[model samples]
Target: MLTVELGEELLIIKSEQPLKVLSSAMLNPGIGRYQYFVNRTVDKNYYPEDAKCEYEQFLQQYTMPLQMTVAMMTAVQQRFVMREQYVDGETTIDVFITAGLGNAVDVTQSYQYTYKPAVGTINIFVFVDGDMSDEAFIQAYHCIIEAKVKVLHERGVIDKQSGTIATGTSTDSVALAVKERGEFHAYGGSITRLGALIGKGVAATLHKAIDGYDAYQKGELR
Candidate 1:
């Protein structure tokens, strides 16, 4: 099973047993750096305590109940009034998304503003149960990416050959946690379930985030 806990700044994803974990993030130069690596999970200590503490402190300065956090949680489940902490995939999957669309762009007109920097970024983390091959993992990642772009297009933020809606952002990260040695085909049999749910989760979340951005830009969010 996978465990997901949403903190003020960080999103903690872990598995019940030892599994393989891969994480990547594109961060700004001054905020800090995230080391990329592929490692087997023997225990639940994935992130460093000190860095985690600093992240929380940094997050406190922002407004409470972050819109990104709310969007992510809301994607997987309906209703955000009870401070609900998770979206259970019935032990099959767990996904989380964080969005900051301050630098959002219309893929068609991004060339007009190439020199400007993005104000924020989005990070998504996913956890899946079952033993999967390296190929399967890569395929899953691609599925998630495809879903993200599709969502952006659905909102008119992206168009055919218009590039990406998150062009100027510094970080758009994805972390996948897959269980080790399980009862699943390792030779590319059935990875659709994993990909499909993740796609749905991301699409729903990104739609909400984009909607929020539109509201703010029109002076309706405040």
Candidate 2:
């Protein structure tokens, strides 16, 4: 089983066993086997010239083996983070997301706006209780990205600079983790069962997170 803990400034996900993880996170990125993943919340105005150093220093507060953890940071508040679980027989997937659209963007367009402190970001963390090959893991990651973009498009999220549907925020990030146990999967795509579950879980969780953030912005939610 996987456990999720929310702190004032952090969200932590720990698995009963180590997992094969692939992520584009600021801390402990890339493909690795990990037992823990984290999303730390920073102030919306927080920005550091050396983000690498900032991540390293922030991680020092934890006692877990840093190498066994994958971590990402976001400006979204912890109260707005959302989670969803999808289960199909023996397979289970958990999706956790924190989203803010202030920096939404259309990837095909270019902008020359001055660099500013972080205001918004969308960070996704997915945990699957299944064994997947390296190829399948990469495919699952791609599927998650597709789902996110689809939801943004459907929601009519527009980029301020391009006036077009945003594919994602400029600082968006995701981490996909698959357990080392369960029936091995060779392919993970929208058509496959594993990928389908992942896609649905991410789409639902992300949508809810965005809605929650919107409410927060309007003072409808705290």
- Error in Å for residue 180 of model 2: 2.0
lDDT of each: 0.46, 0.86
* Stretches > 4 Å off in candidate 2: 111-117
Residue pair clashes in candidate 2: none
lDDT of 1 by residue, 1-222 (tens): 444444433344434444455555322111111222111111112234564344444445644322112111111111111111123243355555545554455545656554353344445655565666777777767776777667755665531234555432333556655665544534322246556666666667666655665665687755
- lDDT, candidate 1, equals 0.46
Residue-wise lDDT of candidate 2 within 81-135, one digit each (tens)?
Answer: 8988899767888889999999888887745554344478899999888788777
Clashing pairs in 1: none
Clash count of each predicted structure? 0, 0
Candidate 1 segments whose C-alpha is farther than 4 A from its true place:
2-5, 26-91, 105-113, 158-170, 181-191, 209-222
